[model samples]
Target: MERENAPVGPGDVVALVDGSFFMHRTYHLAASGDPARNLRPSDGFPNGAIRKFCERLLGFLEAGFGGTRPSHLGIFFDHSRRSHRSELFPGYKANRPEPPADLEALKPLFRDAVRAFGYGCIEAENYEADDLIATYATAASARGAHVLMVGSDKDLLQLVGPTVFAFDFEYGVPGRSGYRPARLFDAAAVAAAWEGTPPERLGDVLALMGDQTDNVPGVPGIGMKTAAKLVAEYGDLETLLANADAIKQPGRRDALLAHAETARLSRRLVELERNAPMPVPLDDLLLGWPDPDVLFPFVNAMEFSWLGRKLGQLYQVEASSYPSDPRFAAPVAGSGAAGLQALRYDAVLPAEGAPPFASDTAHCAVSAMPLSMAHIDGWLRFDFRSPDLRAEPGQGHEGWKIHVSVDPGRVAAAWDAILPIVAEARLQAKVAGPALAGRLGDSSHRQAGKMLVLYAETAPDVGRWRAVLTRVEEALDKAGVTPGPRVAGDR
Candidate 1:
C-alpha cells in the first residue's frame, strides 16, 4: 500500500466502487455467450458482471478512458445480509428479492478482481456498499483528494460536492448510443439531475418523492416534480414538514401532514452514512496497477482471454499459449455453452490419493489467501462412477496427457489450458476456486502428470474444508456438465 513520493490531495483521484450495485446488471449480461464481446469463447460459463467489472476497471487503471487515472481506489462490497438501515426499518430495500443465482455465484470473482489488482476491499458486517462509499468519499475529501463514487445508486447523489463526485459509467455508456463511456457528476451536475435542488438536499427530495423500489412511502400523492419543488422551496424535509400548514395545494398539504413520519423515515433511509466503521485504512486503499502474478491467472481462469492477454502485455508476462501448442486445445463444452464456462479436458490420472486442487480433478475447488501466493492449498474430490472415467461407460480414458514447461508461470498456464475440459467421457475439469493465487508454492505443486482422479466412492465432501468451498460447489452445476451415465459401485 506504500507509495513512495506519491502526490496526495488535489490531483489524487480516488474511485470508491459499489460492488453489489453491479450484480443486477451482471445477471442480465451473463445470459450472453460473450459478456465482454471479446472473441466470444462460448464455454457456457457466464460471469458477465464480473468480466465487465474486471475489464473496465483494468482499463480505467490503464488510463484507457480519457482521464488522469485514479491514484487511490477502494472497491466496497456489501456482504452483510442486512444493513443498519434495514435493521431500523425492516422493510427498507425488502422489496428486492434475493440476488439472482448467477450473481450470487460470481460474487467471489468480483472481490477477486479487486484483490488481483492489488486494491483494498472494504466490507462491513452492518453497513451497505453505499455507506462505505460515503465513508471513503468523506475521508478522501477531508484530505483534499478528489473522490469519485463509482455507482448509479441515486441515494448516493447526496454525497456529491466539490471534492466528491458520482460516476455512473454503466448507464451513461448506454446514453452515448450504447458506447461504453464514463459519466461523472459533480455538485452542479447532481443539482441539475435533481431539478435544481442542491446535492445536500437530495435525500430530502427523495424523502418527499417516496422510493417505490425501497418501499419507503413518501408523502401520499406527491410526485417527483412536486417533491423537487417542495424541497427547492423549503430546503429540507424537516422544514417542509415544519411549515406544511403554509402549503398551497390542499391535497399536497394534507399529504404532507399525514405522512410526515414517513417522510422523516425515508429521509433517514436515503441519507448516506458519512461515517461507518471502515474495513480498511485510507492509506491501505491507495491504488496501483494490477499485480501480474495474481491478475494473469485469474483473468485466464475467468476466461477473459482478452483481458488476460492485455494484462500479460501490461505486466510484460506470457499468459496465452500459441494456438498450435500441442497441450492447448479448444474448450470441450457441449454445444451451445457460454465460452467462459468451457474448460479443456485431459485424461491425466494422478498417483492414488492426491489432494484437491483448482485444476486437478473432474470437479475442483481452489482457494488461497486473498492476494498472497502463500501456501496455495485446496483439495479436489473426484466423483468417478468408477476407478476410471471414460467417454463410453465400460471403457477407459483414451490416454493421459502430461505437460511440462520450465517456468512455473508458463507451466501453470499450459496446465490451465489442458485441465478444464470435462464435458465429455474423458472427464473434463470444471475449475471453481480462488483462481487468483499465482505462482503457487512450487515445492507443493502437483505435476500435471500426477493429478488424482477422485472416483465417486473415494470422493469425500471436501466442501467441509471451507464455507467458501461449499459455495464454490454451486458454480459447477450437474446440468451444466455433460452428465455421464452413473454406474453405482463402479469405483
Candidate 2:
C-alpha cells in the first residue's frame, strides 16, 4: 500500500497526553533520588527528571506545529494501581517496580508544574489515562476535530484512523523525532511483515504468543514468529484452536492446544477499553503558550537554566506587560567627597563642626549599567561638624561627609523587605497627597534636611533600593538609631 503524505492544514488539533506514563518513564530515567539535591525543602524528594520532562514537552509543543498555534490540548494522567485493567488481569503492570522514594515525594511538584502551564490534568480512580485517551480520542474524532494522541505507547495505535492519529513523540522525523503519527494499526503493513495477517489481529496474535513483557504466560514453547504464523494460517486463535491437529509442528501444536484458554485470556487483556468514561470536553481543551508568572517560577525552581532564556522570549511575546530598563547618569571619576571613584547610594548623618552645606559637596557616581543602579537605593551618608561648633550660637563649620554604601549581594533581600513600604507610600501619594498638603504638616521637616537621593533614572524600577532602605530601617530600629528628619529625591 502507498503511504499518504503528511496531514496538512491549520485546523484544530487536540493533544490527548499520557502524563503519568510519560512522567513515570522520564522520572525513572532522570531524577537522582538525593534529598540534599532536592529544591523543595518541604518535601525532601527530588524531581529532576520531571523537570527535564516538562522542559522537553514544552519544547516539543513549541516546535511541533512549525510555530503555528495549537487549537486545543489537555493532559491526562493515571491515578494509581487500582485501575480497571488491574481488576481485569489481576497482574496488569504488577511487574513494574515502585517509584523511588524521592521520586514519589516529588509527585505534587510535578502536578503543580503541569497545572502551571494551564493544562488540565485528569486522573480518575481505577481508570488508566490510556483508557481515557481512547475514549476521548474517539469522542474527539466524532466531533470533526483532528486528534493527536501524544505518547509512545503502542496500545494507542488502535484508536488511530482518518481523524485520529498516534504520534510517538519518541521517534519520528529528524527534529520531530518524538512525533510519530500513524493510522490505527495498519493491517496491510502488519500483513506484509507478518506474512498476510493484519495488525488488527495482533491482539489475537499476542494471545497465542503470550507477552512476557507484561508477564502473561502464553502456550509455553510457542514464540512470536510461530504465533504470527499460526494466526496467519488459521485466521484467529479461535479458528486455529478448532483445527489444532492441522498444525505442522507437533510440539508447537500441542502447546497451542493445551494453553488455548490462556491465549483467549491474553487477547482480552490486550484489547483497549474504548468505552471508558471520560468527562473532559473538547471545548475545554483551549491551547496556547503558558502564563509567564506561573511558568517561570517552576522553571527556575527546577533549575532548567537553558529554558530560562527561552521562557523570557516566549514571555515577552505573550505577556501584556514587559520589564522596563532602568536609565543611569554618567559618572564623574574620583569626584566623591572621599575622592573615591565609586560612591555608595545611601543616607549619611551630619557630624560636629560640619558645614550645613558641606554635604552638598559630596558627588554621586552613576553605574555604567543603568539597570544595576536601580538596585542600590537607600545608601546612607554622614557629615561631621567641628567640636567647637555650638548648638544655639553655632560657631565652627568644620565637618566631614560620610558616604554609606550597601552590600550589593544583599540587595534582593533588602528589596523584599522594603517594597511594601514604597508601594504603600506611592499609593498614599496617589490618594491623599492633596489632603496632606493642606493639613499644615511640619514645614521644618520638609525643608533643607539631609535627604536620601536616589540617583537611578527610573524610580519605578528601584525595588532593590526600597528593599535596602527597609533593611536599613530595621537595623536602625534595632540599634536604637533615631533617623533625623529627611526627604527623598529620585533622578
Candidate 3:
C-alpha cells in the first residue's frame, strides 16, 4: 500500500535530513558521556545509550510530521572520513575531534533504527551527509520533486531554490501556539537579513571569514561583517583577491593579501558538492508507515515514556478518537467588534425652518440655537449648523452654532454631563468651516451660500463619544474646516 503512493509526482516532496549530524548533536546535549567510559558494563552491553538516542530522533520525526505526513523522507548520514572537499583543501574539517566513544558505538544502531522506521538511508564513502543531501536534492529537483532540507546549518542555504527549501528543525520551541514549519531561507531572504549579500555568494563570504565551528580557516582577523562588505563590493573571493589593492583599509588589504590562499581554500570547503551519488531514487523517498507496535517497544526500551505517550496520543487522534469542532468560538466577540456597537440617529432641528437665508436678515441674526436631544437607548447624535448672518460671502461666514443631542433618559444627567464634554470636544472655531467660508466673498457664494453642518454620535460609554469627537476633530483639522460655537436643543 505504501509503495503504491511512493512515486514522485508534481506535489511530491523529498526531505533530505542530516541524520548523522543531528543525532550526534542531540546525543551530546542529552547524555554528556558514557557513565562507564570505554570498559564495557557488567551486562556485556555498550550501555543503553543508543536506545535513548533513537528515542529522541523518533520523537522529533513524529512531531515534525504532526497531523499531516510528508510524501517522501530520506535520512542522509556521513559515512566517509575523506570527502571530495578534502582534495581541494587539505585541512578541510581536520581539527574536529572524533565522535565520543558512546556515540560512536551507537552510530550503527542509529542507522538501523532509521531503517526500522522504513526510511531510505544513504551514506557514501568519504562524503559528508551534506554532500549526500545536496546530491539527493539536486536529483529530486531534476526529477520534478520538491525537496525540503531539514537542518539549521547555514551552509544549507545554498540548496534553497524554487523547488528546494531549508528547514531549521532545532529552532522549534515547544508550547508556541503555531505550526512554524522549518522555513527555507531563500536567496532574497538571506540577502535582506544577512548583510545584503546573495545566498550563492554566502559561501565565498564565509570562506573569507572562515567558520571556526567547521574548522575552516578563513582569512585571519576579518570577521563576518567585513567579509560580507568585501563580498558585496567585490562580488566574490576571486575578484576580491584580484583587486586586493583596491581595498581601502590597510588592515583588511593586508589580511586579504596575507591569507588569499586560505580564503580560496575556505570557499572550496564551504561549497556543497551537488553531484555526489544518491543511493535511493527520488520516487522511493516517499515516507512509509513504521510498525507502531515495533516503534512503541523501541520508545519504551529507551525509557522515553513521554515520547511513547505522545505517539499513542498521535495515533489515537489520527484514528478520529478525538472530537474537534469546526465552529469553535474564537477569542473575538463576533469576528472583532462586530457585536460591539449599533448605529442610531435623532433629530434636534425642526422639520420646517426658515430657508436658512431669509431675504431680509439683519447683522445680529447669529442665533445661539440651543437644541437638546438624547439617545434613550445609550445612543448619541450631534447636529451642527452654521448660518451666514452677513449677506456677504467671506465676512460673516466664520461663526457656527452647534446643536448637540444627548440621551438624557438613557443615562441620568447625561444632558448636563455631556455639555462640557461636547464643548471641550468641539472643533476649533477658526478651522471649523474655513473651506466653506473661504468662498464667502467670492461670487460663487451667491449661487451656493456657505453652510457648516456638524454631525456627531454619542453612546452610553463616554469613551466612545470621546473617540468619535476626536476623530471628527482630526477630520476637520485635516480638511481645513473650522466649526462655530455649539448650541443645544432644537429651536
Candidate with the greatest lDDT versus the true structure: 1
Q: Which scores higher on TM-score, 2 or 3?
A: 3
lDDT of 1 by residue, 127-156 (tens): 888888998889889989988888778988
Sort the candidates on lDDT, descending order. Answer: 1, 3, 2
* RMSD values, in order shown: 14.0, 21.1, 28.6
lDDT of all predictions, in order shown? Answer: 0.58, 0.52, 0.55
Candidate 1 lDDT (Cα, 0 to 1): 0.58
| Per-residue accuracy of model 3 over 229-297 as CA lDDT, tens digit each | 988988878999999988889999999998898888888889888988766666777675676644554
State TM-scores per candidate. Answer: 0.64, 0.54, 0.55
Ten-residue stretch with the least lDDT total in model 1? 322-331
Error of 3 at 16 (Å): 1.1
Instruction: Give candidate 2 regions above 4 Å deviation.
Output: 1-11, 31-45, 65-70, 170-197, 300-305, 317-491
Task: Please report the candidate that would top TM-score against the real structure.
Answer: 1
Clashes of each: 24, 31, 25
Candidate 1 TM-score versus the reference: 0.64
